[model samples]
Target: MKMDLKSKLLHAVLGAFFAAASPVFAQETPNVVFILADNVGFGDMGPYGGGELRGMPTPITDQLAREGLTLTQFLVEPSCTPSRAALMTGQYSIRNGLSLFIIPGTPNTLPKTAFTMGQLFKDAGYSTAIYGKWHLGIDAQSLPSAHGFDTFYGIPPNTSWDSAATVPGVMLSHSAGDVPEKDLIDKGPWIMEQKAGGELKKVKPFTLEERAKIDVDLTQKSVAFIKEQAAAKKPFFLYLPFSMGHSPNLPSKDFAGKSRIGEYGDKIMEGDHHVGQVFDALKEAGVDDNTIVVFASDNGPTGLEFSNWSALGAPDMGSSGPFRGRLGAGTEGSIRTFAFIRWPGHVKPNTDSYAMFSIMDFLPTFAAILGKELPKDRPIDGVDQTKVLTGESEAGARETLLSFIGADLVAARWKQWRIYFKDEVRTGSGHLQLGGADTGFIDRAYPSVYNIEMDPHEDVNVGGNFIWAMEPALKAVMEYEATLKDHPNPKPANVTNFGGN
Candidate 1:
């Protein structure tokens, strides 16, 4: 399915012709390109808070926000796998068995039973592909192609961390483009997957220096896929979950020293460059006006009052803007992520929406755009926001959102009030100020609460006065628990179905 240079150009021309004729034959369904950044902070971009402080050049992301609506209250799960699972299935990860961390070479696949957003769009005749991180599962049944994507590539589990995959004497300088075919190998711990949920077809015994440029390779592949699909006269659903700003923050040689804050900032700048490339590709394909491009993070930043890594100490981890806490703490900073949506001619440009929108809402919202009803067999935690997205309405409400550290519901945001059922306190683990939290410290007597409308940072605690506010939230959780009891997640563990292959 990989296209060569000439083939890509030919397909691009054909696709353009078909697109031009599309207006006469049928009303075109919008193509969707969802970009999810790994461990990006709430204030990492120019539109967010990092623009003024951090010297990372994020003009593309900022321009995208200016050309569309920037959502201030968009939320997601505090971790990678859980956020992705909720995003794809429109259900909480706790019910889906992906609430915990996903280890490599382990049984951490999402269930085949759960109908995903990819399947929904693919079933509707959209050409679907996912290039980049697919952390849902490493197994065949749990891979991206199995979950409704027609083509899938890139790292299955995750990239190698500095603590694990460092090597010496590797070449460090190269153009941010495709590597030579002769350098490809099929043996290495960090093998880049090629087939759709298939075995490792390509790998290389590359040094850590070479591996650092994976984000660039992913971007090239993604743009090529977009062009190929466009040539085929088919609309596409491209889910590009970038592996940047994660641990072992490695920027490509082309982007080295591009940022003022060093390696992590360089990676962010490089990531924004890739975003610009994608946007440019859309425009080149003549589908810029019709394409629905959504940019957001899987979770919050990697630093702050939570788990601290080397990148954080480089003082390079993104800021959480005005929020507090970091990833995996069930705080506002952990769940509140940057969200921007752009659709030309439909959604108003340069507008801001404070509507509480969850990443889970995407599936139902997309379904609404297709004028199709969601399947009635199961419960969906997402609400349709067609009006909210199209600029027809300024007001929207998710009303309640549950934040979890693992299987435990640590915090619940009910409208303006957020109640913390469990206290997450950071403890020094011999790493000085760099520490991890001692989770599950439930305070039954005086659980801390915050009015999010007044104090978005969660600094002031008014648990006693807002104790009554938890009444309706607790009832809602009770009702949700009842539904889960009825339609329990079948694979509340990994999707371990390997048929002797």
Candidate 2:
């Protein structure tokens, strides 16, 4: 066979073109933007029934539901740090070694080796930036930059809202703000090094004014980052975990009194406005149609002072729709919160799905989108719900979900049944019980079981009569608990009395 050199070269070029175009020819890559609201209730939006939002109304949130898919059965851990940890690792908080609320000085932190959503997306060729709250850990090693984000702007923890006398972590700001020295003071049992320009420096305490300004500056930085990424013509994964609705309900002057429900409601409205700004920025950059926007809360509303004001008159302000219990409890209200996804053309407009999904599902779902494989050796608690979100599947993606309260496995939501291992009303700052004596681990004498589909409020306890029927589900929970001890990651520092205030 005698082939000419020119002909051979032409064939080689054609082959190279086909090989490079294979992926694009098979799939379309979409930019992803995940927006996480802090302590915003399930019913705090117009679509979910929060009454009038801002001044005019919350048309932006409702517009998302009308134009995309709304997840009615989405769930997350009861608190901020645990929820964020589960979300990033695609595993239960216990498995990731972040089982409790990560206090400022807690020795426990998310290990760098663990996989995060940002890491996965970045490996898959997406530019990742995390704006807003990063409550997982405050150390530079635990910052978003180290966790695979190309750019990081925002407060390390929402605990910055706590008085200077209370919290021990520092607030890192990218703009001008007065940071309290105490805020930067790390009374930690762990050591941290800060990296700026290629040099490492030891961080010290700062002020609340500095921390507060950091949040505001981060919003501006986020807007700028999105614009820059869009200009570069690259796919981006922007994880905006806002701190507006969490605590110290400090709404900007413009948003104050915008809502009739007091400071908490005003803060929520402020969060909504920031969300709208992000969307607007995307539109301005001409990436709105190609970006997948997800809006959800880390957990339910906090029963703090400001939030209580809304509870007094506006029941809808912090309502978890038909769910019971608030934040920090094993009840549905604590775990089940607002979740909305908007992807133009791919998802059905104004469509809503009641399929059960969890925050841990984000990593797997994003993996599915990027055609990335999950770690085979590690057990991933999240299921691939990409089809469910894209309107390709109507059935629930997960059959059961294990909810952990600190190190304890307190609740399990399987099918329509939700089993609460103990009865304890979460009060005070910590997600701890209110009464004097501690209600030890499992009050096996009387576990509460509710067919959530029928009694979403969890008012009726069916455990006594349906004990035999729930045996199989209970056995499943026990089996799952046993697997936790064998998790490949090392156990985190035990947090025995961290939450009880």
Candidate 3:
């Protein structure tokens, strides 16, 4: 039948509607908000174990576990910079010549040639902003702004370097008015400012009152950034790496005395509240739907037994939860961490995945989400885990993971079994022993093996039962080493020697 004039016009209008809006509606880019906690232990939160914050219940992270997908076997490097490198570049820290935190006097920096997550998202048409600790590097070219972020406002190096005692002239000009505030607070707050391609400048001499407020300030900045992008109807990536739970654990005044466990518990509780605020901001800005929120700790807890925190003036390192080792060790307790993804409508709520997951997996996973290809010229240790992250498939691409201490391949995890080539125990001394392979060398006639699935703490050496688990791990190392022979680790600047950058 022949259509009348009105019917024909309506059909034409409808066709134009879908044509104009289909791309935006069908595959609109999802915004990403990555929240990272520093050196949080396994049993620190409610879902894992320490959610009560020593009986003070961190409702925020607990609620997130209730609403989002928690990866029970999430893993990261035992330390900071390496974990950051893997999360950003999908490669081991050694591959980028970054096996340790960028010390203040050291000239270490991640090579300029490395591609990063920030660059990837920005290249894919997302506005990227980082508002928190950036320990990767503080050199001329190592700033976050240089690596695909549109804005970089956070601490560089770390508290160890940023303190007034370490950096000369760190304390800003102050008077009696700032003294009372200073008395209440400790340490100075030094903020960094940088444009996408501009110079890196540290805003010196911010008040001591400022240190106590930095976490809150960073949280607000992150929320504002998300709101601004949401209002502009643009996809964005906000990386908020918290600087809490580290030594001299300083929680804001609001959370200072809120926890029963002391400084560390207070800091964790503060972090939990910040997380809740971030999620709240997403909902308030009307971008809750179609947004992917990932929450995880940088690594495991600090020290093996933190019960001495009371006299040491350190925060509660929390329990190892189900694991045995702590930070600084190559044990599961130190490497395996808490992780979750909240992608509305895409990921099922309250889903707990036992599949092996790694911070390195995010690069390829986000690449897949944006329909972009992973870099082909360089080696990418990260496997695409979009299917697992989105809950579409319970099986993920990661089947094995390598645990390291500088150049030492201390432990290797293959499925449920683990093999330890070298003895790695997390102690104050052990962490200090990092930076070389010979530090913790333990030449055992027979390697130690454990079934992680059956013994989460890695207490039972089931090598006799799973005797075959050792070859695959050693084979994995051999195969990886073989590739490096031809690739020859270019060994970027500043891994060890100062002024090397």
Candidate 4:
């Protein structure tokens, strides 16, 4: 009953073609729960090799991996905002003018024109809600409610964790009477919420203490949403973007000091517990076998190399597994992280795929699976990855992904080759700043190349011998440029620079 590689590829291609041509059959639609962990490295979880080895036990997530397919080559944008934009829009973040992280009060925001996954599910008759971390924008047009979610809750609208540290960090940095301390601390960024077609409202000040315990509230809301949807027998889409492992890694009081590794370890352990709670809710609702669960990190961790660990009183920060560099840098570890997909009977359990899957591919893949059509008005970077996810194709539907850091195409991955356009070295501080680092880019005489399959660490450059590989990588770049000629991107949002087109 087993088909050979050629036959499988042919069948997959034909099946995709026929499915697209035929009218959507009245098949069972599975509920979707996508859990996006921020700043989690590949080696941080039990399944990918962290867990107890790193003094953090993640038995719950480990079991999730065992019951589904784990991706070894899942790729994402270099940082949080870009990765999340790509996930929601099915386009490169640059296309949406969101290539950089949106700083508080900056002009940057998710454009009102972009189509999102929340809208996609809502149009398909699924109840949709997003809990925890909507870093897209603070304005009404950019919030989750505008994009199609029925409800959204978590951190302040349009700000990062730095907003939580504002009470002392901002209040103390400035002279007294420059701004009232009470107003600065008390009226600072608060936990915010919004319902569809409703105004975004503040709930409570997002203090350092609240930040430590925010994940618990997010998890509780998600469980309630799932239960509510199940009671109504409606297909639902739940996007749980956890605020764990980002920075100032604070675990709840219950999990504090429970891990051997420090605050960072405790946070991951806490995240594991919350993931288990969501899974249990699905089972208790009797939707366990009829739902698709995707657990993935937006990007890699912030290793001690980028931050001052000694000052934070933590022996370690985060692990990039076997790769080099951390979250902000242009390296394999920065973009390549963990992703697991579980759909009970649909996805084969305990399998691993080395397919080149990008975060942008989710929208189109979900559309295809749900028998919905993607908008034809704009260029969608994501390809249909249904065949890959359904075990019909071992080789995924995509081979190339371009990585950008504020309009600059820093790197490109084609097949097993990772090609770098510039040489970037970390400059001691500014790792959490706008551009990801206080580094300078050196103009390389020739592009650096690494065969990722052979050299996972990117220790050696084989570009001289494989100069021909750069042809395909550059071709991908040229093709993207060609698209910009007719359908140009909006000027990218940059506070420091004014030279984007």
User: Which candidate leads in TM-score?
Assistant: 4
Ranking by lDDT: 4, 3, 1, 2
Off by over 4 Å in 3: 1-10, 13-21, 24-27, 157-189, 206-209, 304-315, 425-439, 492-501
Error of 4 at 392 (Å): 1.0
- TM accuracy, model 3: 0.86
Error of 3 at 464 (Å): 3.5
lDDT of 1 by residue, 412-473 (tens): 87777788787665566554543122333455665578887788788889877768988767
Cα RMSD of predicted structure 3: 5.2
* Candidate 1 Cα errors over 4 Å, as ranges: 1-26, 158-187, 194-200, 205-207, 304-313, 429-440, 490-501
* Quality of model 4 by C-alpha lDDT: 0.86
Residue 271 error for model 3, in Å?
A: 0.8
State candidate 1's TM-score: 0.85
What digit string (tens of lDDT, one per residue) describes model 2 on residues 170-240?
A: 23342224656433355422112222223223233323444334345556767897899889988888888
Q: How close is candidate 2 to the true structure, as a TM-score?
A: 0.81
Per-residue lDDT value at 8 in model 3: 100
Q: Candidate 2, which ten residues in sequence have the lowest lDDT sum?
A: 188-197
The model with the greatest lDDT is 4
TM-score of each: 0.85, 0.81, 0.86, 0.91
Count of clashes, each model: 2, 15, 8, 0
lDDT of 3: 0.76
What does candidate 4's lDDT look like per residue over 1-501, in tens digits? 999999999999999998886633333588999999988998898888999999999998889889999998889888888899999999999999888878886888998888999999999999999999889998878999989899999886577654677777766677545877678866778898888988888899899889889999999999999999999989999999987778877789999988987888898999999999999999999888889999999998876553443225674467889887667677898899999999977799998898999999999999998989999888899999887888999998988889888768888999999999999865555544322344456768789999987998899999998999999999999999999987899877576765443
Give a tens-digit lDDT track for model 3, residues 1-501.
Answer: 999999999999999998998876445789999998888877887888776635657888878887889998899987777788889999877788776655666555777888999999989999999887777777666778778999987765443312522222322334333445444233434566677878777765444345556789889999999899999999999999876665446567898877877777788888889998999899999989878999998788775243343434544565677787766677888888898799888888888898889999999999988989877888888899888977777868877888766656678888888898876532236435332212345656788999877998888888888888888888878877887876666554333434543
Q: What order do candidates take by TM-score, descending?
A: 4, 3, 1, 2
